[model samples]
Target: MSAETDLIKLYSQRILALAADIPHLGHLDAPDGSARKRAPLCGSTVTVDLIIADGRISDFAQDVKACALGQAAAAVVGANIIGCTRDQVQTARDQLAAMLKQGGPDPHAPFDGLQVLGPARDYKNRHASILLSLEATLDAFDAATATSASSA
Candidate 1:
């Protein structure tokens, strides 16, 4: 297939649809933690705000200013993030990275939907944008943990 075809495949109808309907697409008020990350190559940015209770995410929100791939990723995570533990989010992020960078398996269930981005594996420059939402979420989780530690 031609390069144009590859680009078309990367932005399929499903991806566009997901992008159009991202969940939790805003900041939370007085969130327990917040973090922002930018993909320098694409100038894509994602910011995540979350609250943790009993070591699981109790509430989550994100503001995404990125391409369709990034929006789709944020949509998936936001739709499933509630009640998740930090380890679950971290594992999903690591698995998605491996899938994109090392020909590894798709992220486990819940995050397995990220396999829709398989075509993006060949586009190195887009990788960072695609991973932006999860990166911000992880950072937010770390921030929440630190805050709890300091308050203890």
Candidate 2:
């Protein structure tokens, strides 16, 4: 198959629709943690802002400047982030990374949305773009987790 075919597969209808309808597309007014990440190869960027309450994501927002794949990933996170914990998000990030980098299994439930981007693994150049959302989310998690850990 041509490389373009793989690219097309990476941007399926679900991905396109998710990209078109990105949720939580804004900055939070009072976030417990926030982070921004950029994909150098594609020039895509994502900034994540969030608040934690009782160890779960209580509020979330994002400013995403990305292609379909990255936007889709952000959409997935935005769609299911409420009530999620740092460990859940981090595990999903690790699973997604393994899926793209080592041909590992898809992430567990909920995060399985990342399965749609599986085809992009062959295009190493796009890896950063596809991972931007998760990376930014994880970075945001770092701040929330640190303070929560000390205070909890």
Candidate 3:
């Protein structure tokens, strides 16, 4: 089968449905931190806003624009990030990058849902888009943590 066909298969109905049902898909008023990431490869963009409480993600939101891969990734992140810590998000991001670029194992625990995107590895152009949500989210977390630490 052609790469296009494989790409289509990679984005199964389950993924598409997840994309359509993304949680926290909007802006947050007076968020603790916010960040945006744009994939140069596919013009995919994801902006994240979040609030942290007791070093945990207390609330989160995102605005995403991209193909199904990006949407699905944002869905996974949004769905599971409610109580996540900066370490968890960073770890998930690192594991995802390894999985996509170096054939590493899937992400662990709360982010194991990202395993659904494993097939995306075969499509190099989609990697950045798939990682956009987590990238932006991690950035937001970093900013929030730094601000809190400095103020304390």
The C-alpha RMSD in Å for every predicted model, in order, reads 0.7, 1.8, 1.3
Stretches of candidate 1 off by over 4 Å are none
Across 1-152, the per-residue lDDT of candidate 3 in tens digits comes to: 99788968898988899889999999999999999999997899999999999889999999999799899989999989999988899999999999999999999989898888988888899999999999999899888878888999
- The segments of candidate 2 whose C-alpha lies over 4 angstroms from its true place after superposition are 146-152
State the C-alpha lDDT per candidate: 0.92, 0.87, 0.92
Candidate with better lDDT, 1 vs 2: 1
- Model 3 global lDDT (CA atoms, 0 to 1): 0.92
lDDT of 2 by residue, 1-152 (tens): 78788667877888899899988999999888899999988899999999988888899999999988888888888888888887898899899889999999998877888888888788788788888877888888788778678988
Q: Which stretches of candidate 3 lie over 4 Å from their true place?
A: none
Candidate 2 residue 93 Cα shift, in angstroms, is 0.5
Question: Largest TM-score belongs to which candidate?
Answer: 1
Candidate 3: residue pairs that collide: none
**TM-score of structure candidate 3:** 0.94
TM-score between model 1 and native: 0.98
Ranking by TM-score: 1, 3, 2
If scored against the real structure, what TM-score would every candidate get? 0.98, 0.91, 0.94
